[model samples]
Target: MVKLIHTLVDHSDDVNYCAFSSSCLASCSLDKTIRLYSLNNFIELPYSPLKGHTYAVHCCCFSPSGHILASCSTDGTTMLWDTHNGQTLAVLKQPHGSPVRVCRFSPDSTYLVSGAADGSIVLWNVQSLKLYRSGSVKDGSLVACAFSPNGNLFVTGSSCGDLTIWDDKMRCLYNEKAHDLGVTCCDFSSHTVSDGEQGSRYFRMASCGQDNQIKLWLISFVDFLGCELKYECTLNGHTAPVLACAFSYDGQMLVSGSVDKSIIIHDTKTRSILHTLTQHTRYVTTCAFAPDIPLLATGSMDKTVNIWQFDPKQHCTGSLLEDEPKMSVENWSEEEVSVWLCAQGLKDLVGIFKMHNIDGKELLSLTKHSLTNDLKIESLGLRTKVFRKIEELRIKVDSVSLGIPDEFLCPITRELMKEPVIAADGYSYEKEAMENWISKKRRSSPMTNLPLHSLVLIPNRTLKMAINRWLETQQKYNETT
Candidate 1:
């Protein structure tokens, strides 16, 4: 059961796309402006209409943290905005100035990818506001793109009906003719389900095309072995071409909008229609699910956006539960830290940790000097072990608190990249590791598992300098701490 909560008739032209973050809803229009609405009460923000594009805005999405918003336009640029005040942070011009069709942020929000009408896709480093890499499909205009939940991979759909998967480094992993006509939109679900194989997990993806069908796929990745895509099922609920499809936060429900001016919500587990909504009088162009709530937003060519509300428990048992008040590692108490230490097989340190009253924050802040002088740990080996564990914990916590820059790590070694070089596959790698890979006759790319077209390796001076600057920042932070 679904209820039409509101019909926002603000956009003068067709609503091209609509997306939801945790607290905000954004919709871009052919009128060349984007509107922001507070999810709390559906009121238009004070800076509701963000106007900067010289041409029509095609797509818009918010960063994971909802601090930054990205929008692409026929103006041949993807503009980054400070969501707090709607101030333009940066404008990234597309290569060759092609009209940008779609833009999406990686799951981690560290990267933003924009696809253009000329089949070119540019990956941008969000922090530095610089172009990281660029690639083009063999045929058709690139119109749709989505990043996998882990942010390790992304797929782009083109007007040629091809779906191409690429690694984080911009290396093409797989290319397939997904639709007979053209692909309109695609999305990856946030939830993972077991594939019935031990140690193998897969995520579901929904892709709609002009062929009047919505297709489901299972995308699974094996470390360094590349990714595998399997056709799960085909859905033909729409009488006309399906334009947009989105999965619910829990992956229990999938919603789609089509040319027939209808929106259908399907139960992913049962592969059955849950609800059919026909509130819009014209073709529905885009739809999305709210990240934290059971709300759906659909945009239509009738120049209206419909917001729908539903009960998740009615659809699936315990589908979405209110988050319990769980503490992050930094907020863990001394007892919680002791339990974590025991779980990590350091039970011997529990007594010492209890004596020192080390909480999670202090545990991460511990160094070799602190372990020897403060905790009175005599053995250098034990001190080294404790320090190493603390460092590992810090890395994990830092990754969640502040995302670890992926560009600083080598795709092959997963270590901080040193002496970075660009391979023929359009990905950067450590020079020694890449040289060894080539010398060992491993002609395929480690990231893509595709043959290296050329054996050329060019020094990536920019990335090298960026990594050095990041290292210096980290060093200074450590010294200050």
Candidate 2:
């Protein structure tokens, strides 16, 4: 586990962005070409090089499906490539006046969004091969834009300290001047909870800024006349400008990389520092957590990406022996037990199975009949029987159909399988698809290759009004049902 996995060194100059496919890493650099390196530890040089940008390639991203690669460059252009054939499918020319700093594909891989030094944000329809709409922020340069997990909303951070949220249709919903200095990064977290009654959905947003602060906002219900969005809390800690921030997949931890060359992990609830990772020798540029693994990756100006493995068992043991002395099961009161059970996503099991209430009652006698046979009654000596019963229950639960909506399904493969494989048209192409697409496109499109330019203007007020209306409609639907 502590081995050097891979070292991708094809970039002739400073690399700005590095993203992962299922089996490869795609990196963009000031050298203007995006390089794809195999994830295998043995592979050294890039498996393929995509060269098309007339200037430095600022950012490169893989679609959620991993079947498409979208790249933006200092040439003021964006290109879409067919991941399967290494073909340039489309070229977006001069989308902005200045260099495009960053570009990202929508969660569904149906759209592309780019931010530029010209203080403009452009949304493009991938399938239709058309520029949908462009909005001007009228501030400093646009740094980053991220679509929410639900794909229904997105947030853009600006160099002028503004953070704006927009709908999927490219309408600005919430506009706020969030910081005294430029905002560097932001992310959204959604969690499901059963608060004594029934399971409900909740979301929170985290943002970092050049003002040396990390702020958190709970997306809660608001009794308002115009908008239902409201800011909840601001978590301030970093001593230097924060460069990047991301939430764990489980929405329990928040990690922020800062210009101070440190990565800080904060508890999502308490908004308190859990760990301060200080290994990087230079400014930590970016950090991301594996979606399904207990691994954290940090990229730095030190020219290295450090991968940290999180050991939950060791973390629990250390917590139990901390100076403050964490409360154990033996010290739990009635209220604490309820909280623990709820926190484990077992709210329905609360009060139904109490150790104190069990006397001579048969294991299946006191509970709901439907769950009795499903339960595994065990003893210290009945190890074999207990394991068999546990396996049976797991199979039964796995077989149960929860009727999850298609929207909740992963867009990559349109399925609910664990560790989902990225697919397109019923085929699972290897990770090289994105790189192949970029390479093919560059060879075909010469006229579209140009450098980016910059400009500044105000965002459209009409688009903001439209987005506000859409949010209000969704809120009303949720409230009614």
Candidate 3:
């Protein structure tokens, strides 16, 4: 199921976009500050928030190696920041007549691409930190731009739904109408194509727009005539305008978020909706799945970023289970199984069966007598409905789920410190709470009312590790028992 782990609400204005790196997550806002948060500790990094842009930062992207972060803004400029120390690397301001709506880094991190509302696409050289070149269309504003997986080709999508494909040398290779209204988002998959048709399927790109539909474009390589772009298929389900779409690292699943406040995870091979995640209440502005982890990060106009992960045990048997006739119990796709499970409730003994690593079909194959008398299920009702029949054996959550020992509790809030910091008063506390006391409230630490020497909040990594280990142990004990 798509569980909302955290609702980040630091931005004063609308959170325009969210991007992820290996160890950090970056978000830009209309507040005109780009903030970086630590993924490991879930706390805002110190000395963060590169604040040079004059206007609302619209979009941000991290390089392939997670070293550099590039952001664009309404100020008509792009700023490159060092992700390590939160320092501004360079500012490539070309003075385009319109706001730079989108920015992307090449796979190799050698080039940076920016698309502006003025219909211009600028390719900047990363090493030289200068304008490598630029391309423009006659009309319409460019809303999105993406470099091909190979980085040799790039694409620009406009407000008029026009798509222009360009090469590394800034030459237009393909120009055509792609969607109705405007193209809001586009993503490319250059990862090795799955299946035997790898001979011709060199690259594929998925595009979504205000028209409420998604089109997949497949580019095939020819012997001598270069590459050709052909329409592969169109996916339809979203009733409202689709805002953003991203492919997983493996390029096997594509997730799209829409103004309808829902996310649809689709199978890239079958072109079918594997799951529909409806966790966001407002229009989801952007969605990106982690290239390495199973986490999916989504940002909304509601001023929040949610992290979702796919868990295998929670899924109900349906989509992939239908193929259980041909395959054994061990051959299920964990992601697909999770998608089906997120939609339904956990049925009684079914959850136990799943926890015990019992196959879904094997449970369905049992008769009512076998289910009740042998497996100890009183009444399963029917096999089809047993997908959600997982209540009886559900994990017993305690009043305090983490069950952290009293020693780990913060001195002020009484809650376990997610970001524990050792204040100078010889007391440990949540950093934000401690900061509020000493910095904002102009008072000394609660433990020692005497004026403190310093307000520096040194992170307590050892204590945090202890807290995390305790939480993980309790969570695993709950899950298994």
Q: Counting only residues 3 or more apart in sequence or on different chains, how many pairs clash (N, Cα, C under 3 Å) in candidate 2?
A: 15
Query: Compared with the true structure, what per-residue lDDT tens digits does model 3 show for residues 23-49?
Result: 888888888988888887668889677
Task: Give the runs in model 1 whose Cα sits over 4 Å from its true position.
Answer: 197-199, 315-481
Top-TM-score candidate index: 1
What's the TM-score of each model vs. the native?
A: 0.66, 0.59, 0.65
Number of the predicted model whose lDDT against the real structure is largest? 1
> What value of lDDT does candidate 3 attain over all alpha carbons?
0.73
Please list the C-alpha lDDT of all candidates, in the order they appear.
0.86, 0.60, 0.73
**How far is each candidate from the true structure, as Cα RMSD in Å?**
20.1, 21.3, 24.2
Kindly list the per-residue Cα lDDT of model 2 for residues 234-353, writing each as its tens digit. 554465899888887778877788887878777775454455666777787777665655556666666566666666553312221112113433344555544433332234444643
Superposed model 2: Cα runs more than 4 Å off: 1-12, 40-46, 83-87, 190-201, 220-227, 312-481
TM-score of candidate 1 on Cα atoms, chains taken together? 0.66
Q: Which of 1 and 3 is the better model by TM-score?
A: 1
**Model 2: how far residue 289 lies from native, Å:** 1.9
The number of clashing residue pairs in each candidate reads 0, 15, 11
| lDDT (tens digit, per residue) of candidate 1 on 25-53 | 99999999999999999999999799999
